[model samples]
Target chain A: MSTIARSPRRAAFFLSDRTGITVEMLGHSLLSQFENVPFDETTLPYLDTEEKAAAVVRKINERASADGLRPLVFSTFVNPQIRFVLDSANALHLDCFSIFIASMEAELGIRSSHAIGLSHRVGQPLDHGRRIEAIQFTLEHDDGLSQRNWQQADITLTGISRTGKTPTCLYLALQYGIYAANYPLIPEDFNRVELPAQFKKLRGKLFGFTIDPMRLHRIRSERKPDSEYASLKNCQYEVRQAETLMRREGIPYLDVTSKSIEELATAVLHQAKLERKIY
Target chain B: MSTIARSPRRAAFFLSDRTGITVEMLGHSLLSQFENVPFDETTLPYLDTEEKAAAVVRKINERASADGLRPLVFSTFVNPQIRFVLDSANALHLDCFSIFIASMEAELGIRSSHAIGLSHRVGQPLDHGRRIEAIQFTLEHDDGLSQRNWQQADITLTGISRTGKTPTCLYLALQYGIYAANYPLIPEDFNRVELPAQFKKLRGKLFGFTIDPMRLHRIRSERKPDSEYASLKNCQYEVRQAETLMRREGIPYLDVTSKSIEELATAVLHQAKLERKIY
Candidate 1:
């Protein structure tokens, strides 16, 4: 065997020319894929100048020297000056891992399920072209937009009692800054003939959140134990039919089963390709 | 104003022993604090061992040589060996700023918050204690922990329709691993003879979450327009009485007004001095 030894510790740097939090979150989750070796991370930010970037490399080099550390760095920013900073840094035993470096190779070589850029992936000009444009306009408006056109919401979520929707919508609003408006899909509206006209025309925006039949059954069972809605079979049927109708209409959705509101929102963003609006 | 020219660009590194995401968040917040010159940042990770730490320093030194990068390294980990590595790296850098170094004078002068290990300023005993201990057990056995003698929850959250208790409890469960069990404080419960006896005995474990009356009023106003329950006056009265009852019972509480769920949870943890269970 060659004399290449693998060290137990690996250092990673999530560097960015701007706010490095986004890159760090992505890197943290991606690194989570590896369960064995523990990951230690540090971030460097505002890497706008050659001198500042070089200083960052120096710190990395010194740390590596002390601990015999080899590090991976992931950086994203609009600036090109950061490259020189990493290039001139003590490259002896340091390894930089930038997504940009991978993106080129990924785009050229393999098939990627996910596309780059928030606008391209999320605001696809195909099926959701109109609503996406409308959303863009809504965001550009000055006065509080939600109060103006909430009834015209593309996607409306209705649920009896406490099926989480508002928090999820707020998360969507805050994260992607999407103009998300929530309508409580209540019991009265559940039996209504006309789905809101806006949602009818923009069915693509209409998504539903449902929990496991047993979990919902149990949840409602606690509130109104003897009610027919709390019965497992009835709960199961409502969920199944609702899901079937959504599927037949080609409306995408996710089961909010046993997931934290954050996890659910993250999954929704991932699946729905909702570019989380970074605040 | 002195003779030595001060460049507006300073080099900063937001370092962490483990996940750097929190550091990144802190860094962004800190940058927002500074109105003047923008600084640059670099990130590094996987620094649990001695060799890795040395390598990071060497890289820093090399970069310092090429550019006048006044490196500022903010890290949370404690390692005796880092001193030797940093000493060597300092030979190249004119100035350095490490939070650990700044904290050292205090450490040497004063007895540590803990007998051994880093001080409490790093938010030691990072756990929410027993409530979260129960939550972890429940999540690990999420299928049916309620079936067991899990009735004695530390604290219980109760609220009316859409008052944000389940999501908050789930957040506590996920973040602190607190076995937060919530029961709806329905109209019937509101009209009960007494508050739950479980809270009476375990008063320390009991806390309340209430939002501003106006917010509650607006939230209710949306769902059941023109209804007495949704009326601003009713919401205000109920909220006032709820606050009064909580105060009378000596339960600590928070106003979830215009705050994100994360902010609310953090405030609660801080108020409770709940040790963040660092995973």
Candidate 2:
């Protein structure tokens, strides 16, 4: 055990001119490295204008005074004036955007855009349309509702209820613009050796998801408590049968019981060789 | 206008043992620095096994031989053996995990668990329940479908059609486990200088989404072409009225026209102070 883990807690802020996702990720990566200090994070996003910047400054100053400790601020402000204001606030700060953008501008021999949405990367505008399209597509086709479009889908996920198919598919769509649709796997399907008949034609785009039987029982029980379907034996049997079917059918699958949706979706995309619709 | 704009396209692979999102983000950040090059991206996620590693190697070599251009590989493999195997592949590689993990281990006197699901950042497994809960909540409460649970939401979004309310709310839920619900701003509501009736009681939890009228028109027009609702003038009128309504009601809002769903979600959480369900 480290003393740092026992150290006093601190307030951490992730500030940005836009959504601040990039800066948050960057800051989280750094902070995750230091496990001793627990963080209570406040994300202040969309500081695109002077007024928003001033408001953020006021909050920082207020926190410092009230808490009697300097807050740790991680910002991705592309505008110099706003970044200056944030930096001047009574807090320890790390700016993720300016350093990277400035270095890139110098190396590339061009002035950076300094726009509000630069954190998403540059130059291509079609990504927005594609991402939005993918989201709409995924939502419409979610949970095997609209299998009519699976032929057009970049990938289709199949797993038992509560195996994390919906969130994983949504992550794939929202983050990468991949058209991902999911179908439920019934315990009854364990009767047949093959995958569900609905997904048979789309086998090329199909992927499998599995979870630990204990975790699956817990998750399913939440939806339907004390039911046979939620029983531990059933959960174990379903998972085993599903895995056997997947292996027998040569389908790549992930055990998502321990993984976040981000991990599940990313793994599926890579293992399945699905091209991101946005990029 | 630079000659680099004519640069030949190259293959880019985001390879990882877990979700490739971190490496992909790092890669997109780096590739976005240059405006001239085009890329075909393949995400090789969830390469946890030696068999998967071997498969990835074969693909890389195949591409290299076919294209006569070694692909740019961005990897976050923490296992020394997998990292070695990937590095040995004939590709220009950038490792995001090892370098940072090495430095951190030396500083903390702790070796990383090198776990496959660790990119979501260590410990306290309860995040799984919270994330699942948030996703379920968002799905049920989506688009003001069931406002009976409005009081329970961390934040509710209001905006005209296609201003990015749904995807942004979904992002908040999936990524940060924030219970985000969204309501659409109907054209009829523009006549009244008030917020929607559904989310009136939960005003503090309400945030508005605004978009450029031209962009709004483009988006709406796609859903319903040449319709009175999707007209440029209607988009302009609805946006102006909505902003006025939000301002009058003393609600904070974000202009999402130029922002990605990731950015929109992050900004809303910060601006609205929605406590991240995960952190």
Candidate 3:
């Protein structure tokens, strides 16, 4: 067997004028491609001022000196002055905005606003209000807590326990302003071939999640040790019965054994043909 | 006043081999800068195959032909063949990956893996497990449900109702693998000047949220209309008392009147100096 060599650790920074979530995510995407070089990542958010940019520059330069290599800096500052300040650092600065904004402006024949934090601003008060409303609605409808407004839900996810129904619903509500509700499918429902009575009229809005029995058993076992609910045979029976019921009812379902919450949410949106109310 | 002219609406597409969240967000950032140009945005994710890329090309071309203007296409496909298929569309293509990957590869003197869905994959099983655990812990600890593992929390948020404590805590747990717990400050807690006994020993882990009295009144009114709990007087009293308590107890706080959940979570992380356990 060949032994793997240890790679050098490099420092990477994700800097942005706002929350920096977008910048950090995009930077992580790029850095993940270079699997051999492990990155020590740090995110510096709300760097709208030149003073803050200068401070970040010192940090980057110090990291470069310590590593004996130039650090990689990914930034999304809209203000040119702040971008210039960050560019002064002794690192490979990847300006996420400047690289494309110039071309976009040329194509559109209009100047950019150069406003900081515009991406995450509460645009269209109605949309912002809807997002909050969706979150509240989602929380109220979690785990089939309240069917008071079941008809108002944009999508309803049904699954056995620990199939990632709650987190996926929350992500849909948080990110896209979708009024997502989740219902758990217990043994009682699994015993019947028909869809649950509450979901009969909402068939089109319903989606389902299934997981590998082995994975489900492991997940449940963690939550409750040595309980029949977490038994392997019980998990297998639940999953098989749930999938069979979903198929019999013609409900489209996804396997959540390996999907992330973001992936599950996006898949639900795509499969359910739901429009994103908020960006 | 000068007459405000209606701007032309342009079609913009965000294409990605995976969830398309990063591309959509970054594209939105750029599009938001061009305020005069209204963009009708659509995201086509999971375009890992050339057939899907060709289908997207047809749609983009159809949109361009109907609108009599080229649409803007922002993509992050890692495969060259799929990118080439998409480039055949009659649109203003803005390739997110190609723009920076070349420079990154050159800087590091290494070739990228060009792997699709690597950005959101469950890297390091331990990290992914920690994220799930954090989400479960946050959900269980919501609204001060349990103080059994209060010391294990990365951060605990305290605020009066309608101050956006729950959503912010969920965001922290969802995005950063942070074990965030939130406690609602009731009138009883407000009556006491000292910190709550549950939080007395966890001062450093505690962060507070305060909102404008008017805003809090409006938010609470929606839930409990015309009640003393939702009155402006009660809201003002709660705000005054909560802020006074936070100041007296030296607990750092933020005003969530205008901040988004993403912004609030990031601010908490920054102020608390909490390390992000997941990207």
Candidate 4:
């Protein structure tokens, strides 16, 4: 009997008229479901013109022929002519907008604007200003550098070093326009029986992050090899002390050893019930 | 004719089993197309359980009844049971997965794993470590704090004050695991006719940013009001000098007067042809 060969690899493309960040994310999430299929992904942003669309079609067709398998194209193009051209490619074209826009128009009884790049446009000047201001605030307040605007902060994160306070705070500010600040819990604070006096009044806005001692030790060791700060004993003591202080002060805390930055930021937003100042 | 009243606003829900970030972004982009319709948006993340889905259904039904318009629900739930429960709600359900997953399965001839929360999971330990390391590297390199690891950076951004350097670098690091660094060009560098000696050798990795003099004046005036740095004449001189140096050095640059942080970062990635180290 003749043997049949099947390739397990497929090509995937994320095309959009704007930055392609949204479509790439959506496509990535969907592709992650098939655990066995390996996808070679490429993103083509600013595909607003029919000529660009035709070029992409050729590329997709070439990839399909080379791989001996059809490629998957995820597109968020708003222009009908561009979308029609993309559909001619020898691949599975998943038009994200066309799939839902018609149904949404029928439900809302209004025609969509069909505007390209509207998703990431600066909608309101005030919202854009707030996002920029929030980033500035977050940067100025990082690692307890300045406490001048502590009262204005939407949320304050406290944790020992390497527990991911800075990245989470930055993500919250960049993604949601939340004025997030972080203060590190150092050795001096751990020795005190009571929470710091400054944190006492700001308990409502305070949140804490804790990590497993072993993971903290490994992470710190990477920064400072063969040091007391990176030793397991110190990591264990610090984590215990930080948890005690947060519990004593009734401030909410999260274990961040196994969480990603996006997960950590979303958890803070949900638990704190902070309103996103920008969309 | 009998009078009929319809609400101008509709309720929109972004539901997911994980952080719900993907669905929220997709829903927001779709809703943004309808400029005249205002949507009161709410995100219900971690809606993996049937009980939570039931509660959300009741909430959606209540909203539809109160507003006299069917609410819009954008869901990324992978579980069939949970999706079924959500579909029964009195709302126009837009299943981000159901719309494409079946077609993808047919095209690829493979059934999806249907695993929940796999979108944002740490797929590879090496990738996770690289992302954390990239963040640390970026933080250490901000504003030319140190030149110890300049060679390790994927891209180095230089600009006059308030040209959106730090946030764009941080976004590159956090979103794409790109080791990005930024250095500010002060008056000393502006006075010189040539590019900085250190950056001259690394011209390929160097990218410049320039902004309108009036905008720079406005931004600086907010921080240090009524100073020479904020003066219109000084702003004009600095802009001219920076652009001249960049042109002389043949280093590519972008204007950040009206671009958002996302747009700026995406442009750098596209123009620089930088490979995203982590997905």
**Residue pairs with backbone overlap in model 3:** none
DockQ of each: 0.02, 0.26, 0.52, 0.56
Off by over 4 Å in 2: A1-7, A10-18, A40-128, A187-198, A240-251, B1-17, B39-127, B187-198, B233-248
Candidate 4 Cα outliers beyond 4 Å, as residue runs:
A1-8, A121-128, B1-8, B122-127
Q: Provide the interface RMSD of candidate 1 in angstroms, 1 decimal place.
A: 15.4
Lowest lDDT 10-residue stretch of candidate 3 chain A? A119-128
Residue B128, model 4, lDDT: 53
- Model 3, TM vs. native: 0.94
TM-score of each: 0.37, 0.78, 0.94, 0.95
Chain A (alone) TM-scores for all candidate structures: 0.55, 0.85, 0.92, 0.94
Relative to the true structure, candidate 4 reaches a TM of: 0.95
Give the poorly placed runs of model 1, Cα more than 4 Å off.
Answer: A1-279, B1-17, B35-97, B102-152, B158-164, B167-171, B174-177, B196-204, B220-234, B244-252, B258-263, B266-279
True contacts kept of 2: 0.17
Q: Pick out the ten consecutive residues of candidate 4 chain A with the lowest summed lDDT.
A: A119-128
Candidate 1 residue-wise lDDT at B224: 81
Candidate 2 vs candidate 4, TM-score winner? 4
For model 2, residues B40-70, the per-residue Cα lDDT tens digits are: 7777677888788988988998987777778
Better of 3 and 4 by DockQ: 4
Task: Give lDDT: candidate 2, residue A10.
Answer: 69
Per-prediction CA RMSD (Å): 18.1, 5.7, 3.9, 2.5
Error of 3 at A179 (Å): 0.8
